[model samples]
Target: MSDYDYVIVGAGAAGCVLAYRLSQDPANRVLLIEAGGGDGHPFIHMPKGLGKILFNPRFLWPFMTEPEAVSNDTGESWARGRVLGGSSAVNGMVWVHGEAANYDRLAELAGADWSWTHIRQAYCELEGHQLGDGPARGGKGPLRISLSDYRSRLTEAMVAAGVAMGLKRAEDVNDPEDGERVGYAPRTIWRGRRQSAATAFLRPARRRPNLTIVTGVTVDRVAVENGRTTGVEGRKDGAAARYTAAKEVLLCAGTIASPAILQRSGIGPAASLRSLGIPVVRDLPAVGANLREHRGIVMQWKVDDRLSQNRDYRGVGLVRSVLRYFAQHKGPMAGGAYDMGAWFKTRPELPIPDGQLLMSPYSFDYGAPSLRVEPSGGFNICVYKLRPDSQGSILIRSRDPADPPVIHARYASDESDRASIPVLVRYARRYVAQAPLRDMVIAETRPGPEFETDAQIFEAYRRFGYGNYHACGTCRMGSDEDAVVDGALNVRGVQGLRVVDASVFPFMLAGNTQAPVMAIAWRAADIVLRESR
Candidate 1:
């Protein structure tokens, strides 16, 4: 006898979507387990309250990467949401579905089902866009996608600057036809609240009698018998608990936790498993390999105090902003992380946009212990190489489920990645020095004009560069021999087990990952349904 038809680990963006879709059929008993608690915090709903929610221990799983040569021997804090919606609840509400070409490449590696055509259709079914229905955009769906209602003169000037530099002014940043364009960013914020996966997908699913949501349960490992996952074993309320899955066990625990969970279950590299004194269930070396993240550097410029939103974030201004939010849900309190976004090629010779930029009207002191808004008026721009070839790994330190995984984010390790630092820095400088932005001119606050040469700029990046928190590819899916999961998202050497979520991505997408993760889950549900029949 089984406790559920399907057992889902982690209630993040992917897990929420899976729970909802799988439970749509009343006959399927689905159990969704989360290590974190509920998403009832007011900060989780308030769009601009990300700063408050991100560092809150109750809602976050703060994992730090091991120090590497490229990052000046300093560990970087890699935080993911520990709450119901996972990172989607704590993330900067940016909504982007990357380029169609990226999905086309996945189709090449995986199968036709993972192609752009299918993924686009899944997106159309997932979104509820405020811009209304279109051939490409969805209008009536669960996830509400909307443009940020908040605007700033500085952000408008940044878009103008991009247009003057020959970049297309995009109406929809996610539109595939808008190549090399700049525009106000689209976000997973509807009305005034953050439309996280918990809010959009799981809320409705919670009403289903067949769906069971168990939180604050720490999953130890999958209970496998004779190479087939029968269920999952974990600790709940300090007591041992086990749940069985008659159909399948789905691991949607994001990139870090999914791989860690597999390794703990003796499903990773044979050598490592032996060293950890755990009998190897499968000798899958790629279980925790190929970790990828977007590395970017921030450039801040001191602008006129009136043009920046710095004041709205501090002291009395913050109090007023709070009141305004409750009264009308309008103001900085309703804004997303970035005001504007752009995709561009560093060099004209490149066929696709190789770089991405995000602009915010407010600046933060990056070196602060926690994210602290600057007292002075300023704006910041973050520039990143859309895709880098550098790879890393995640390994378990101990068998204890409470222990955090060892993360090795080998940023800027590749020659090309290192070379792009100078190119990106120089490009950002040039972009800000153009048109109307030049008139609103100010001095570069961090890594200023003194860092003119390529070497100097590269050094500046080493000091200030940070991961964009878009980590993936640890449990990569492919048709290759060493791939952890196959084209249909099934574990290579196991039965009744699947690894969904960003962990299965063979490569990282060029933009924010939330949208793609949701789409992947939506498509995976169809695969699971077809296979179950």
Candidate 2:
């Protein structure tokens, strides 16, 4: 058996960062286990390559949620990164901190350790912002944050439209002191290339002899002994292996696998485990509960064929697009799919923005298995409720780690969430109808102009809805009875076991998760290292 001071499972966003941070102490030997392979594929680096990687098994886990009535009995596709950088390698690459209120709420749930004042240090510690040491934004951190230089007629038009409609415009999303209003989001990109956790944090740490990265390994369960996790047991490339941790084991397998691995290790709901003939180590029912994700709808509109990038991808220009990426790294090849965004309230009384709108310069065939951007010419708007009432769960089907668990995303199950759909649509439609966006629109392409009735809108929402892929809350960290982990991020009812990924979030963040996930891991490392004293 191989042994180390700390065993971090899943080399995704948090896992990679935790390994990097913990191994800083030369005496602490850290091991990172990942089921996925390497992050060397060129598609993984290209910003616009996400459309090609969405359904590809090489980069991400192919997860399909159970049928939900809210989505019209359709199973939504869940694309989770299976690679070293985790979802950060395969995500939108947009870096958003959401609003300050979200972090304040986390403080209420976790502790003062997660409050904004203390949390700001971690934010600054991890980000290298474009605004060289602004009062609100950090200048030097492992992750390089830069603006996407790519442009499109539709992207510029959307920005113009946002200004025309009196929406809040911001140059920075991380700063609340300068009025953290929303606008076109920035990216975790550096000079036109993707900068994921793998590229930023893990890359530097990999050269450290104290840190070991074992890819193509499936972490089956936490190796628990005498109520404490000593290490982990899993198969690496079809061969069984055991690795012990001298101090503690941190679960960074993310929302889906983290809970499933917890249950497989006998730390979840006892009754549920016994049903699958797996012995229970703990009766913690909350291990896989409180599953939450944003419900989103993709609305497409037709534009003049000459105005859309769709023409660039059609025939002979496809070769040129590829060459453009290799030469300049910008053009249409550098797209992170989306270029502009807006955050606003669904109603005036709400304290925070209840809805979010993201404008992608290209539209795709939503019904297809693969994301094929419209070859002719068009763009899309993804509308999501910032805070939703809907909730669901993650449950293991059997004791086998190879069999994927069932993800009941149950999006919009709550009536409140259902009611907000129309408001979100109306808000998005109104924004597009203003200024240059309306001028560029040939017509409402998909739902068409006829879908106006409340009932009709709800139906359209169900038909077009897809998982926003921001799932969180399983194995949540809190002091409450239902919390899977306590304020210290230690798994309740167990010693020397911790969870340090998005799975531990009590509630999801308001914006894209990549930025916040890395920040959380940075703080987790501080807590784990400090408490060891």
Candidate 3:
């Protein structure tokens, strides 16, 4: 049997970083386990490959949400990456740090360690930004955050329109203290490749003798003896295996799998464990509670001007673009899913941005399950509630580790979330009516011309809205009675075990979760190392 000082349960964002940092000391041994295969797929490195892996069975997990009641009443795809980097490998690479106030809020909820001040220091040390280096940004760090080289006139016009509406231009969206987050953004892409956590943190540490990287390992449960996590039990190549953690078994299985794993291991709600025929180790109802996702809906338009990326994504141009990506690393394929976006409050008096508006110079064919761009040049503006009051969950259906969970997203459930839908939609519609876009814009394809009233917009949201893929707070962090993890992120009612992924987020961010997750992983590393063996 193989054993290590630290057994990280997933080779995702936080797990990879922990493997790298913990193995930094020559005496410490680390075992990094991954359920997915090697990161050899070409789709993983391309910035625009999100469309390729969004529905791919090999890259995406088989899990999805349960039918909702309030929102679409349908099971929207919960695209968690079954790869080395986790969702970061398949994400759009939008590197948003979120509002400082949001981090401050999380700090208040979890602990002082999660404060914006400490998080700011972690961000400064963990990122390697392309723009330059200083207190506001990282100069020489493992992760790469760079501005996209691809810029289309339509996206430029979208920015111009937002500016015309009196929105302040942000110098850099990734800048922490930047007064305005309402503008175009610099993404987390390196050169022409995607900067996933696997690429940024894991790759550099792979050669360490103390760090053992194992793939095709499905960790089913954490071996708990007398309420302390001793190790992890799983399967590899259809053969059962178990590995002990000398220090701690870190569950970085992400927002969805982390809680499910806990449930399967008998550490979750007693009812859930009994239903699965698993003996309850700890009766924690908070294991899968407080789940939240940023609510989003798209507004598409068919522009008279054929300036969108839709043209480049079809027919011969598609093949040519692939070749161009391999040859020059500068083409339509080098950019991320989004081109420009802005964060603003529905009501200006709010402390932080409660709404987000992202624009792309292309629309997709959502009529089918596949992600296909439109045949003609069209544009899409995605509006979302950055801080929705609604919460959702991911609960296991059976004792089988391979079984998908019952995800109840209940999107836009709260009165506040429902009320903000129209405001966000109307803001995008107004932005589209501004100078640059109004002149070339033809017609609204989605929510159509009839959705003028707030009620109509609410219906549109229910008909088409989906999660922003920022599902978090499942294994909530805090010292509260309902908290699954304590202030130090250690799983409540269990010793020698901890959660260090997006699942432990005390609350949701005002923007994307990638950048914040990295910073959190960096801080988690510090906390883990301070322990005496």
Candidate 2 on 88-129: residue-level lDDT in tens? 889988787767788788999988888776667788888898
Residues 340-424 of candidate 3: C-alpha lDDT, one tens digit per residue: 8787766767766677788788888778566778777789988887766788877899888888889888777788888888888
TM-score of 1: 0.98
Report, for every candidate in turn, its global Cα lDDT versus the true structure: 0.90, 0.83, 0.83
lDDT of 2: 0.83
Give the TM-scores of the predictions, in the order they appear: 0.98, 0.96, 0.97
The global Cα lDDT (0 to 1) of model 1 is 0.90
After superposition, candidate 1 runs with Cα above 4 Å error:
367-370
What local lDDT does model 2 show for residue 98?
69
Model 2 steric clash pairs: none
Put down candidate 1 lDDT per residue, 1-533, tens digits, no spaces. 99899999999999999999999999999999999999999989999899888778999888999987667789998899999999999999888888888888998998888888888898899899999776557999999999976666888898999998789998788887627899999999988899999999999899999999999998999989998999999999999999999999999999999999999999999899899898899999998899989988889999898898989988889899999998987788999999899899988987778899899888997666877778888989999988788899999999998889899998987788888889998888889999898788678988799998988888888888888889999999888888999999999889999999998998877578999999899999999999988
**Candidate that scores best on TM-score:** 1
1 against 3, candidate with superior lDDT: 1
Per-prediction backbone clash count: 0, 0, 0
Query: Can you give the lDDT of residue 67 in candidate 3?
Result: 78
